[model samples]
Target: MTKDTRKTEYGNESISSLKGADRVRLRPGVIFGSDGLDGCQHSFFEILSNSIDEAREGHGNVIEVTRFTDHSIMVQDWGRGLPVDYNTKEERYNWELVYCELYAGGKYQNNSGENYEYSLGLNGLGACATQYSSEYFDVTVFRDGYKYRLHFEKGENIGGLSKEKCKYEQTSTIQKWKPDIQVFTDISIPLEYFQTVLKKQAVVNAGLRFILKDEESGETFVYCYENGIVDYIKEITREDGFTEIQFYETSTKGRDREDKPEYKVKMQIAFCFNNHTNLLEYYHNSSFLEYGGAPDKAVKNALVYEIDKCIKNRGKYNKDEAKITFADIEDSLILVVNSFSTVTSYENQTKKSITNRFIQEAMTDFLKQQLEIYFIENKIESDKIVEQILVNKRSRETAEKTRINIKKKLSGSVDISNRVKKFVDCRTKDLLKREIYI
Candidate 1:
């Protein structure tokens, strides 16, 4: 055996910790989930999420976003500007904790209702991580009758904190940053992303207004929804729905487990059945759940159970017919669920889904009860829903059968009698030696 001198020694000194900006700069994917354009987009959303959280807490009603031709982005919110002064408890500058330290923010004690009742940027890593991954970051906060400013270049603070008396009566926070090319492979987020996200935010935030400005095109777009999801549903269906839209909302408190702390959940649901159009969207804490987890399961379970019961009781199904599935209902149903919880278990930092057991249980139970009441009170609508769902089910079944028949015909064994045009086959039976040419 030969001792290899080329190998590096494994010792205590070899273990090193990433600190400050390096924590996010060195491993951008660990925090933002990507080191490419997606990560840059996530960084933008992080800052936007903070503004959204503040607005949701009733501190603001408007958020402004600007896209510069230089690829820098800015978010301004009329919220209680972030506390960037001093912190007596932590004995550190609030600016340091907010911009320089990860895992530090006011949203951590949400269950206590001290800071935010429901928050989107709950991880506390958004501000610091975004700052660390930016080529240059700037923050301007107006609060406490003073204007506070902080600047960072390449994740390092430039002039610490700049404070001066403010003349404006309204308090606000403005953040501007350019994602660093060094940190991300690409940072050129498109304007369409901003428009879509801002529209979604406006839809979920109800009366809140989002203003987007494109520097390159010199165009400004505004988005606002007075009635939130219900209005959005109407816009999508154009009031051509077969049934009138229904809206239901409720609040509850519970814990995922006996040992877990209890938290509050607020849910709003709007839905209608349309033969020509269909949509289903789920949002949690104002963040769009692209891959809904708890809410999706709850909706599927509750709707299927209730609708199936209604169908069976009304004799809408044919003899020996199977119960309708969610897909059948989905083909003609338009629903939007906006839910917020004091405690959330997001699948990841992206917040595309949630896995809270209590949330699923609560939503499932609440939806079932609402659907039961709705079905009983509106017999005509219930009948129409069942009829439409049945049509969709039968149509899907027919399509499946047709697809299977087509697949069978196409997959039939091709022999000399059924040889396809321009096709050749090998004579050797051995699989290794066989060859088929097109």
Candidate 2:
């Protein structure tokens, strides 16, 4: 074909769209919700999630995070080093292909027989996106007496992969990166944010040791939780007036049909009610569900249902007064719900919310069964909860009466001004003061 014919194309002034690395560079917000400090922080979480996944799979017991004086972050894990064998299809090392290419990871399997049955990272764009969003990214892997290293500058490879004889005995993977200044103008991660995330990860992956170190200050914080979410709840509500936290966990198995593959669900729930409100944290496969979608609603429904059942059995209220409003239930409650399934679905690429119907159903059923059993087994603790509920109901009633009385007294005392009703006096151009009375 002639040179002129080789480049023929027709469109109404069409332009080529960015691809892969370019797209990620231009649209970091698309991958990480924000291209600011929050997104920079999330990039670290995305990289850290891989190490946490290894811990979840029972391959690794320690994950360490370090913040350097130069504002670079490093995450190291003692898992089997990332696959480094040559790939004929990609004509490159597997580790190189996995990082340089977008949507090229092992967590995309949707079938039951897949290796990643319950994964913390849902999307295929895991570390690759983080690499693209970083100004300098390096990956070092040590495995089977071989050490491999790769480096990239602003998503472009600096050189070919290098391999050498490993000096370390244990297999490990270390990833260190500095965020791109052009993308996130200010990429400083808050120390408290790192602590909160690392602590939560340690709580989720019970036996895993999560370490956070400050290279400048030479200070380190180590988090390891044997009891996981149960301990997390206890620590968060330590200062509040609360009953002993109730904990429940169950695993169930079933298949959609006889011909279909079997699926398993494991759920853990720990909750405590106190006199002060606290945020509820939920995790599906170790990913935080910030939006609290369907599964959160299901858990809340189950709590109200079980609590109401306890009240009715004790004859605390008649049929009309039996209903427990959400306000009453939510006023001072702290809860943590974790669900893991062989097959899970998130609402979006960010994985901020989980949206599987089966998860909702399974969690609701699990909570109701376990909570009822708990109430039956611990009658003394159950009675304390019941008393708290009654107290909440009385307080709500008294507050409502006081509000109405105050409103009535105010209305009876204040002179009704036509300007206030029409909002006319407030619209005036005031030189010194303008007050409208109703």
In order of appearance, the predictions have TM-scores of: 0.92, 0.87
The digit string of per-residue lDDT tens for model 2 on 1-438 reads 567556546676676789768888898888887888878888888899888877788888999999987889999999998886698877877866578787777776734546666787767676988899989999999997999999988988888688898688789999999999888857878788889888878878888899899987889999999889988888888878467788888888755446756677788888887877566888888888899776798888888899888998998874676477666777767889877877666777667797766668778887888889988998987887777877788789889999999999978886645425655535557756787455
- Angstrom error of the Cα, residue 138, model 1: value is 0.6
The lDDT of each candidate is 0.94, 0.82
| Alpha-carbon RMSD, candidate 1 | 4.5
The C-alpha RMSD of each candidate to the native structure, in angstroms, is 4.5, 6.9
Runs off by more than 4 Å, candidate 2: 1-11, 89-92, 110-113, 239-242, 254-262, 276-279, 318-322, 411-414, 418-438
Q: What is the lDDT of residue 419 in candidate 1?
A: 69
| Range of the 10 consecutive residues with the lowest summed lDDT in candidate 2 | 416-425
lDDT of 1 at 40: 92
Model 1: per-residue Cα lDDT over 289-316, one tens digit each: 9999999999999999999999999888
Residue 427 in model 2: lDDT = 57
- Please count the clashing residue pairs in each candidate, in the order shown: 0, 0
